[model samples]
Target: MDVFEVVADDVRRDLLLALRRGALTAGELARTRSDVSRPAVSRHLRVLREAGVVQSVVDGRRRVYSLRPDALAPLATFLAALTPPAPPVPARALDGLDLEVRRTTRERRTAHGAAQQEESA
Candidate 1:
């Protein structure tokens, strides 16, 4: 399967995310979530390995897997291209709002000061 097809599966995606932290054995990957069985995880891992999304190494009797981040460069670049640039906010757009806030603050302070003076008198 291709990278896109391999990643389309939720279990395979989860396995990739778990492997992102570091290399993990099949058992370790299986333990990442409780919903999937060990055999299911192994199947997902096999698909990922076949797709070049993950690399595996023999560590004694265990096979450890790690994410091949570079393999995802095409997908990342494609997604980045698809994202539209953010629209720029016009300058002074909030000037009226700012002025109203300042006016409200001044009015409140003046009213408070007048009340205090009246109480003292």
Candidate 2:
């Protein structure tokens, strides 16, 4: 599924926004948003991890999560390319998409490297 579909949930958006500020533990994230339960937050985190939108590292007993930053680039690039130039979609919006794709591409590469390491280990 595309990053848009994966991030369609409100909970996921909140988590992503939080990560944008900096990395946080699951419990910290749960405390940041009361609309979603702690368990629900965990589930959402899992989904984001699977989508390569977030990365988590074990910090003692907690898993500290942060935005992947460039994980959504492939989707963003695909969408940007599909946008019709003659449709007046706004150059500003297209520029934003271009930036997003560049960022996501970096995250995608990092995630791939991590996955490869996991497989080797």
Candidate 3:
């Protein structure tokens, strides 16, 4: 499984989040979540390990798991490539836009004779 597939599981994602703080034993990880059984957590850990999302090593009789952030580089790079660059910002604000609108309206009213009617009233 790729890192993305391994991380698709809710249980696996939670395990990754927990490991982000630091490495933890399988037992410690299992204890953090009551919804998943220890065996299930172990299975998720194995998947993560195989996908290179996490690494494990023996600490005497037990194993400790830690995140491998480099495993996500491909996904990050792919995303960055897909994202379009931001549109260029305008050089200046349209400060005279309201004034231009008022001038246009006045010219249109004068052409239609409304300006003369308003002035005589």
Candidate 4:
């Protein structure tokens, strides 16, 4: 479907990793694993190509599949945006400081009022 969905598949992810080393022909890719048939590998490559995660070009008579580095741009951007900024002082921490200041101000005001009442008496 998309780049993330395409790479979410184990087969497709493996294919991309393999291509990272160098471009590999479909047959070569199939031969690398015993469980996967050549046709299956080809199908996975087709999906990757559609997602733009992989690209293929004719080399001699064979089509070699390679990773498209640009295709990973979306993922990189998404991850970068998600990274949290450096932690600054928290609101709760500031709230304690504010409370202390308010308490001291109230005490000062009450003490001043009491002194005035004493002087009047």
Q: Which numbered prediction scores highest in lDDT against the true structure?
A: 1
Error of 3 at 99 (Å): 27
> Between prediction 2 and prediction 4, which has the larger lDDT?
2
lDDT of each: 0.91, 0.89, 0.89, 0.87
Model 4 lDDT tens row, 1-121: 9877887888877787888899999888777765888889889889988888888999999999888989989887888899998889889889989999999999999999999999999
Candidates arranged by TM-score, highest first: 1, 3, 4, 2
lDDT-based ranking, best first? 1, 2, 3, 4
Q: What is the lDDT of residue 76 in candidate 2?
A: 75
Best by TM-score: 1
**After superposition, candidate 3 runs with Cα above 4 Å error:** 81-84, 93-121
lDDT of 4 at 100: 96
Error of 2 at 19 (Å): 0.2
Q: Between candidates 2 and 4, which one is better according to TM-score? A: 4
lDDT of 1 by residue, 17-48 (tens): 99889999999999987899999899888989
List the lowest-lDDT window of 10 residues for candidate 3: 89-98
Cα lDDT for residue 9, model 1?
Answer: 86
lDDT-wise, the better of 1 and 4 is 1
Q: Write out the backbone clash pairs for model 1.
A: none
